[model samples]
Target: MLNGERLTGTGRSKLTAALALAFLGAVTSVSGTSAQSAVPKPGASVFTTDIAPILQAKCEACHRAGSSAPMSLRTYEETRPWARSIKARVSRREMPPWHIDKTVGIQHFKNDISLSDQQIEKIVSWIDAGAPRGDPNDMPPAREWGNGEQWNIGEPDLVVMSPKRVVPAHGPDWWGDLEVDPQLTEDRWIQAIETKPVGVARRVVHHAGTTLIQPDGARESLSEFAVGKYGDIYPEGAGRLLRAGSKISFGVHFHSVGEELPVVIEVGYKLYPRGYVPKHKVTEVNVGVINGHLFDDLDIPANSVTRHEAFAKLEKAARIISYQPHMHIRGKAMTMDAIYPNGQAQTLSSVDRFDFNWHVAYVYDDDYAPLLPAGTILHTVGIHDNTAANRLNPDPNQWVGFGNRTFDDMLQCHVLLYYMDDAEYQQQVAERQAKKKSQTTQNQ
Candidate 1:
């Protein structure tokens, strides 16, 4: 359990402001009926003429040529067959993959390819209208690619690489974790982080997350291990500590996607601390372990809808700073309510449709924030589908679990908070960060 000291009123209010959003809520949830309403058959020429421009401008970057996408939509011939796939993913708000919130105001990346409702509708209408390829002259110029090798800021001070893991030729996907030790050069404070593969190992390796060694300043290979799950609870020690001399043991996991090869990787961290005084502690609440009771598996049905609920009781002096809900492909919808001891309740998140691939953390504005006295129950309600439509549903007929490893399913919720008097925790953060810096410097 995390240090649960109650936050001060001023602390709660201010921390709420500082805990702004970290992702794009670009994906919108759509019901099966709504999804079907968005697609049109090949008779639509606008899908080739007008709609093609949208895909080229917003999607082709990652979906074309040699990218990791499952298929290529390089031309009308290639795209004609996947019209339904495009419609489903787009209507469900799954394409142009962006996770930041667009309903309220939020910044965006320069290369952001997310689609607006208007854009989505336009494509849908064109397909429905028999897709007129307007005219060749109407086609917008193709987007030029700039070198992406440049870092978001500049060179990372330290780079940690993992050992090579082998994959057999032609078989089921491999699920394994590899550890890395990055001895820091000097004590430092990191503001950002990124990871990449070490060599030409395309068939293996997907994504990775890490945890730092407690008190010892060593990195614990958490995501890699299958036996000892650090914890399925949120705010757990699932993060790697960063301090001078801190040794990092990163947990790397990859899926086969039906290919075979060996893989290695380098995870990078960017440091920043010059802007403002760090007072309130910002964190994440991961929703997991589901259903009628605590830590129990949910009994949901295939080709049906099931609702799961969870609550985190808050202390009288507590106030929620921000909230985020996560679920995989089977997720249909989600909502959060803050119920006080006095019976007053505040709605936190009321999403209509939940997209597993588009789930993200939602940070609310402090102006209209809610405060709860003791007995404040932060409630989360989520709807799920295990039908054939869910692309990631391994066995739509089979149910899954809440543990990490990605194979099992989860029906839980987390409420990340930033509270007052979190200075001590922040100090611990700083101490560990310093150790990471020292370790990086010593290694150099």
Candidate 2:
């Protein structure tokens, strides 16, 4: 999690001008697609048979009424006004809100909602052909969208919710730690888990991570959710253990979007039967340095790109399941490289173009999980562009530092890994302890 308390950066209004340029540029680029005179104009009949179906299948899930999207696109009337915007968005491959660059990294995600290039072309072609009112009959049957009442996956065995917290209409971003008790009398194994935002919070909430607090004041992560993130389901043989008398706490980061928003986030847990035991223990760890001195000194001179590096040495052999690169608006690129003690290096995952709006956790397919051995060093590199050329730059002249605010920046390579068994986990713990003692003895 990015701690805002350590923020060190100058604020400026120059970022506003950059955002304006970005918006105008996007509109101009999309309009250019519509100006292609050589492209034959396909009429309403083409739209009826082709475009309507695509929207129903691909865009309606989020763009429908009562959803997170600002407008409904369920019908022709609802979608007609935003024709140019739709064309622009699809033309840029910015809609559907999926951020994974399919060409790089692992591509097989279960919750991927990205529009194919072919689909994007279809939308653009329809717009160029004068986005017609397609035949009502040709439109596919309206989908029965969920209203947050039912879980996407069946009902959970246990559901815990945070108390209502009001987000101010205009204020600095806020982070809240909500503590709740699950009141379990015995241990349990979590097969899957999900967190849902109630009311307007869905739109304003940025990120949330769940932690389990023990009676002895120790804490461990239970789950984490980013924007557009679906719940997590561990592999059949792996599950997270929850001991009795544990408390669940949610660390929620909220962004203000001009209107007061009320939020009460609810977490649902699907558990295995009481007698079931998992073959492997699933856990998550922050691999790279975050909000530390090295990361905080992120000073990008005007018109210059800054690169920063951090490393995390592994004490155990583990299999990595997923990767999520964390940075602010200025972040241009990020990559995670695994460097072995033998001096061999391999790139685990890389995001060439980081989008502040669409944060995705790239989960590798079962066959492609990276198996990192003990003594491997995870190196993370972050590239930040603070020049005027960056559309999202708030202020290119201002020096940015590690902070929780959106303007302030951070570099975090969040990785999820798990040991093969309890024995392996204990062995890793002991090895780390012994290494720490050895270092202390040498220093003394």
Candidate 3:
């Protein structure tokens, strides 16, 4: 259940959407009667309808013969023993790590693999109830995966590929900043964005991105204000600013993938038409913590448990349509709670575990996901554990802070939002519709 009352800011609902996105796309599911029959009973043939489809739709892409995941769940023989682990992740809403608001209107995420609640129940029940292998005939056909490993959706409108940066096969995992010249964009609003794949010696890449900033030959940027450890959440609390006439360059950070595979990185972004300009320029919000003097730096190690909070007061009220939750390895989870003056705290987003590498923008539904009221106070809380037990932990003993470097940790909830101009926002929607209609008519 929701922990508190509805929030009210000046921009009201507009602020809600923006703040909510600060969280990774994890959601709270409300259940009644347990509906406990979702999982299949044990002692049956786990065929197509029973299990193959689920694995294909959710696991095959990454777990295939030579891929990133640890093991492949391609065949029933391979999946049977590990059914327990699979069911666990699904029950926790972890697999198919998607981060979009499903309660909202008809919206699709650029990168989504989340299973429905019912589906999760089925997997769980099947295991608890004795994973019934229904029948071989019931099993659906297996799918063929491709080497391209592109988005499930084929062919984006535009593809901006970044030049490759080679990392020596052996080392302490080198980190460097590369400047990308976008050929030149005459002011184009990006509609969709992605990171293109480059061959690597190993999956050693930590994180890479296109930070829209001043083209003043800056290799990297610090947060808006670094407030020690606890307040590191708002290092760039106000959001990173992208000035006019600036080039969006790649921020490349990688560790040797595996053995000696050199690292190469590429970026892909699709832009809106030249005429369409969002009222608000690009802004990426980070709502994590900074270490404080009150705590011992050594005690607050990388994977050691820690806490922090931050706030961003909006000057103009605008509704946010989408956002992204991000954190380095040490970060366990995060929440962006909008606290009203009346003490109401509404959950904008809460991601329990964040994957720094696979970050993407998320657009919420129309109704459930909207803006917060103006005058709303966006408070974000971040949790981190800089410890040796952390699988992705780089350095458990080192004191951590917010930065683009690997050793340093971060707590950020970045978002892409637009000003709430009823006329202009709607006009852009209409223009998009008209363009679609005209193109359809011409094709027909």
Candidate 4:
């Protein structure tokens, strides 16, 4: 299962079909039962028929072998021991790892994999009933995983391997840059990219990004990999430019787990051929003011919850694609909104409870994508908790500010967008003005 890909195209159709079938099957089972009937008794038999399907659909993608999850729950034997743990996490709405607040904004998403409240109830009841393994025959057919070490999006046009490096034991976290030549003969537009940590290095690797190294030593991030994200997959007809002769560098941050380790990492890119022009040129903007301004400086006093904000005004009309909120530890919540020139405001995305480890880009569904006029203001609000209640906080007694280190804090609102051309942008501006005039006349 591709956990992080945009849930459109053939994928959504297939999912819809599967869901229809599941609904029909469910209807047959509940035909004789009242809507308010008692919750079904939990047992091993219940585990096989009810609980297992939920796990397969919601949890197994990351919980299986050779994945990011700490344990494999592919079988009854494997999952039996962790029944209570699973119940606790799902009961708290933490397992499926989706952070966006569903009620505050647009409620449609292609990649939402969170469990429903009923599903959570079923799992909790099953665990309370002793997590019995009733029958192997009741298990849903096994799911197939990605081929060994293969990219989930399939074979890439180019692959670059980073030089192997050693991580010292009992040392501070390390940030290293590795330059690898992609040896491309011409420029290409990248559709998707993935980074793989080979050998034992996967355990200690915090995050890695593939960047384009400039002649003057500056670098631009192209793709990234982290704990919960599979890779960078753009929406349909969208891509990022990769220049010819550019050296691909991996900006790797590795955290020490109290042991020395050696590891090798590789990055793979799926590309559009040369001369292939994309419909949308995708770009990401990080909005913030860091020079001690209340909104950008991001100062969080100890034992208090603080909120800061930033704004980005668009010079071109653009379609908003996604928003990825970033913070180290102590991050609590974030909300992003688009303010049109006419003073109308709408929330684009809001994460009420932010998790540093389960970071993901919340991509808008095609029909729900927001188009902003040239002068629209993109505003971001970020909240941080520096109290001791924040378990990940290193020191609640000390104030926190923006920095690269883990103990220090950062608040970033990274928005992905596709800018409209001059003619189309102008047309949109005129249309908006006309609509505003029409509304004012009606009000009068």
Q: In TM-score terms, which candidate is top? A: 4
Candidate 3 local lDDT, 1-444, one digit each (tens): 121113333242334323342331353321222312234444533445756887887777666655544457887656655554555556656566664445533344433567878777767666554455555577677786655435422344545455666666555545565655555545555544445345442255545556555557542232110000001111111122333456556565555433555555554444445566544553444443322321222125544688766666554444555556666667666666777556787777666566544454455554334455555666666677777655466678788876656556666666554444556545656665787689899999
TM-score, candidate number 2: 0.76
Q: What C-alpha lDDT, on a 0 to 100 scale, does residue 22 get in candidate 1?
A: 11
TM-score for each predicted model, relative to the true structure: 0.60, 0.76, 0.64, 0.78
Off by over 4 Å in 2: 1-45, 168-175, 181-186, 199-207, 214-221, 225-227, 253-261, 290-303, 314-316, 340-344, 372-376, 421-444
| Candidate 3, residue 313: how far the Cα is off, in Å | 0.6
Model-by-model lDDT, in order? 0.51, 0.71, 0.52, 0.73
Give a tens-digit lDDT track for model 2, residues 301-378. 676799988888777777787787878888888888899879999887777778775567777766556767777888
The TM-score measured for candidate 1 stands at 0.60
Instruction: Report the C-alpha lDDT of model 4 over 228-254, residue by residue, as the tens digit.
Output: 456667877899877777888887888
Q: Which stretches of candidate 3 lie over 4 Å from their true place?
A: 1-45, 84-94, 98-112, 125-134, 144-158, 166-176, 198-207, 216-245, 252-264, 275-282, 288-304, 341-343, 355-362, 387-399, 402-404, 421-444
- If candidate 3 were superposed on the true structure by all CA atoms, what would the RMSD be? 13.3
Q: Which has the better TM-score: candidate 3, or candidate 4?
A: 4
Q: For each predicted model, how many residue pairs clash, with residues at least 3 apart or on different chains?
A: 56, 2, 68, 3
- Candidate 1 residues 121-190, lDDT tens each? 8866553443344444655665554433334435665566767777665555444455445665455544
